[model samples]
Target: MVDLASLPPQLRRAVDDEMRRLRAGDGVLYGDMTSEEAHDLESADGRALPPDGALDRFIAHATVPPADVAASDLAGYTLVGVVPEGPGLDGPWSSVKRVYRRPDGVLVMLHEWAYVAEGGGVLGVRELMNASVRHGTARCPAQFAIRRAPTGQTVSELRWFTDAKVFTLSVAQDVLADGGKDHGKAWMLRLAEAIE
Candidate 1:
């Protein structure tokens, strides 16, 4: 069953709106209702919203599949997902997430964050930290490390700029837990080069 209880409010709203659109005639060529009608029908499932109006949480909605939010910048980001494995290496992906933008056109974040797997095998990727932009575009040269966080946990972080996209892929340093830091660093560098 689809589970989206963890998405931030704005991302969740994106998925919910996409769901209603897909179910309405504008998308599926089915549904005997106008877009507004379908939206209201979906909203009927909501109850006393919080001070935020709560929007449509969709948690109480049916257990069917979650919607694929293909709107604006959100769609442009996940077109080619960033995961280490070849095809089907990490099992099906969880929900796609992006930084929220207020209706007035201010971004909650400058870069995006997303993860492909979870737990010990998780592979995470985010837009390069503090990357500078020229003409509204930013690109980062390849940089990688197996640094120990302040908490002393080893992490494998790989950053690369290619195809006009800058991404950082990270996982636990377990890729070489048995191997020394030298080996782990090599592995991370190779992985970074392999990323598209």
Candidate 2:
């Protein structure tokens, strides 16, 4: 009953593959029950396999999921990609993220990093302030930079650093019929302030 169709293409495909394998092998919880319901059974009957998900602290190392944010906050964007790295052998030790794009083709990439972790911290705020200056970043509450992207499109980036996490909003310049960095910056700032 999982709505696999609603997931992003990559995630859908991956989950579809896993569901098939599980169904074929009868290895996963399969029934009408919700995951929480199934998990209670899973936990009580546990054989010490492995956790199916990353710890919340580990997930906190990445950008907030698009689903967690209000739809209007996205300014009409839809999530198109996800990079999930969880607590596992080959997956990353921290951080997962999503990519989103709007109808007019504005692309936004949000990335997060934890300042503290169990072993050590992930390094760098994208070398902010240092590199922000090169891109002419200005600070109000945080640094805002309009820099040229590789494709020559401009990016309006808003970044903030805190005791526990670093959050960034990078929006491809030009949005709405009004257009240009001004609109994009307004959009980015609105999204940034709205997030918390």
Candidate 3:
């Protein structure tokens, strides 16, 4: 398991700061929804949310999985989030609500979120996969990947690949960086063990 205690001071601080920022104010940010609410939404809407909403839901949502649900249980499902958009190392892109999921559900989060310059898109599949390996939530397996556009520009495309299922995440400018920072890898590792 990854060690939060072992995290570099800067990375630890960055994650804490981001979490604090996300939790600030009236509305919760990531993982903020109650199971009932999520269940209801899923039943009514038929899919996960975009990053913006997902973050809030993630924050608010119960960290403990339902009695019957396990990390492996999500293998074939798609999760989506609406991420807030923001400036990138380069330029900017339209604020997007992205989707992530694995049709086979073998993968937990087919497309985890990452940040780039304002206009940066996916650069290379390998780079994205590496990012996921480095930055993805501990409880979830790396499912999504980012790549720079072929134009050789900073613009990127955050893409999801699964056995089949598709989920979505909505994002905003503020939270884009939060997704990338290596929060306490230790904490993440613990969370992963708990969930798995």
Candidate 4:
């Protein structure tokens, strides 16, 4: 179980509710895998999907998407790849990633991971940074936070943290910065919002 006492009240409640739903089998698994397929994949490459609540919980707490972006803008994204432990990434955790391509050539990916056994907990900022800045969620506005590379890399990430996992909105820096900081922030926020 997660150390509920360590979390803020609002986040704590969300975690508890999700745990209950997970126990009740009220979770959503994205990829369309049959029992045999899931089992076979698990055997071939150690990538077992989390029972259900991982993605569901993130969606439940995610910020609402901006109204300016159209539904069609979020369409056509699909689960293009999954990396399980062992062969692909040499860890006990597994990740599922989806890709969306807009007509204008902007690409966005939403990725989530969970542990094979105990799931994950909300990580502290220092711990998250030590873990290569991937484990924790952003507590800032939009239910997410953004970090730009100091060296001017053409990629910016907007991350959302849930008690058990992290979701990221990665966009082309040029496309996001086309207008300016406000434009990029708004674009990233819109993508983060449409993730669910």
Best by lDDT: 2
Model 3 segments more than 4 A misplaced: 24-168, 171-196
Would you give me the overall lDDT of model 1?
0.33
lDDT of 1 by residue, 1-196 (tens): 1235556788667766644533322111111334553343233223212313121232222122223334323333312122122123232332221233334322211111223222223212231121211212433444344334334444444444433233444443333556545435454444334332
Candidate 2 structure quality by residue, lDDT tens digits, 1-196? 1255566798677766645432221111111334553342223213222223433433454433322345336635656554444455344434444456667656666655543432444323221232221111433235555444234444455666544445666665533225535455456556765553
Instruction: Score candidate 4 by lDDT.
Output: 0.40
Candidate structures ordered by TM-score, highest first: 2, 4, 1, 3
| Candidate lDDT (C-alpha), each | 0.33, 0.45, 0.31, 0.40
Clash count per candidate: 0, 0, 91, 1
In angstroms, what RMSD does candidate 3 have relative to the true structure? 17.3
| lDDT (Cα, tens digit) per residue for candidate 4, span 19-115 | 4432221111111323553343233222423424533433343332111223423555432233232213433334444444455555455555542
How much does candidate 4 score in TM-score? 0.42
10 residues in a row with least lDDT, candidate 2? 22-31
Clashing pairs in 2: none
Q: Return the TM-score for each candidate structure.
A: 0.26, 0.47, 0.21, 0.42
Point to the candidate with the largest TM-score: 2
Candidates by lDDT, descending order: 2, 4, 1, 3
lDDT, residue 159, candidate 3: 28
